[model samples]
Target: MNTESPVSRRAALCGIVVALAVPSGLVTACGSPAPSGTGSGSTPKQNGSTPTSASSGGALVALADVPEGGGAVVDGPGGKKIVVARISATEVKAYDATCTHQGSTVAEPSGGTITCQSHGSQFSPADGSVKKGPATTGLRAVAVRVQGDQVVLA
Candidate 1:
């Protein structure tokens, strides 16, 4: 009563294997931390800015490294990605860089907005508020402070 061809059966099995393998690979890649000293250990001088003291919170890029109106993506606590933006000369904000839409790492903030490249979601740097759809929720906030020129967790 079975009429499935051998080739067709093999193709279906391959498809199933691929479907399962791809997702597992993606999940592992997404959770793995960025290489050390490249994400969180970047310095102000390395970022094309003035040098600053290395403080706690893992010494994320210096205060001077973050542009005045734009932001930078750096490694945060536990190797999680974080977006650090300077709203003004004296004001700065920090938020989770993971996109709320689908967990894609968000791009650096520009023009005062954080954008997700995967789904075109946008967020506010001031309060981590959702500025566009596809991402109905805002990014999570991360406590940060300026200490002796370095930006550290508050």
Candidate 2:
């Protein structure tokens, strides 16, 4: 009565192996890099109020100078500039130093947001999203990364 166990155990093991194999294959296919260098989270093509232009390729800034939860604006190349913010110990965000509303430079960060002094436009320093009126478009985010003790614009 209780002697028929070997075949059933083998069948169960095979079924479990098949289940795992199927899901693993699916995950591998789903997790793959794009051919281009840029991966997911590509920059938004739609421009806010400000005209999107080439970044000024400004100087490398020190992370310590940028206060946590605050930011600093610095001039860049070709008269362009950048806004640097330290979101956290490991995260930093950069945006085009120019204000999107009227091409004026965005003022200092205020409570996690950047306000345009020229026209009172506000943008999210976290990711450069438009937060207030007179500027319906979000701030153009510039890629930046930390290398050693200095943060470099990427």
Candidate 3:
């Protein structure tokens, strides 16, 4: 009697889900509107002026917006939802926010780990590797680099 879509949960966080044979690249989403700003209810630290994501392939978020030891889930390249973690002062790491065990979007990194609230799964901020169970696999890596003061798609 309960026939819900498998990716229904994802749609809640993404507003749209593109499941066409599982593309290995950045999956476009509606986490936020493009050509404007970042998502997650937090404003990115601005410098002079903001440029559309097109100018940077995809600007995930401002480097300062992401805490030194924590992370934030934000609108990524092509509007995809991605989790970006600040590893060190100048180093960073990023991954597809979607939980590998299920389709639920993973939580923002905290305490040096990214957690899946849906299934008690945990992943490493260092490499997106699985550190806990319910998920035998690790999160997908989303290529990104710190450009100037922004974390951008690579």
TM-score of candidate 1 versus the correct structure, residues matched by position: 0.63
Give per-model CA RMSD: 11.1, 16.9, 13.2
The ten-residue window of minimal lDDT in model 3 covers 43-52
Instruction: Tell me which of candidates 2 and 3 scores higher on lDDT.
Output: 3
Model 3 per-residue lDDT tens digits across residues 13-131: 45434444254222444443443333423323222112123333467799989999899999765666789999999988888788889789999999989999999999999888889
Best-to-worst ranking by lDDT: 1, 3, 2
Best by TM-score: 3
* TM-scores of the models, in the order given: 0.63, 0.62, 0.63
Model 1 per-residue lDDT tens digits across residues 5-76: 566775666566656764444333434544565434643332122223333466677988999889899987
For residue 131, what is the lDDT in candidate 2?
84
- In model 1, the Cα lDDT at residue 82 comes to 85
lDDT of 2 by residue, 105-131 (tens): 897686988998889899887778888
Q: Candidate 3: misplaced stretches above 4 Å?
A: 1-56
- Residue 103 of model 1: what lDDT? 99
Candidates ranked, most accurate by TM-score first:
3, 1, 2
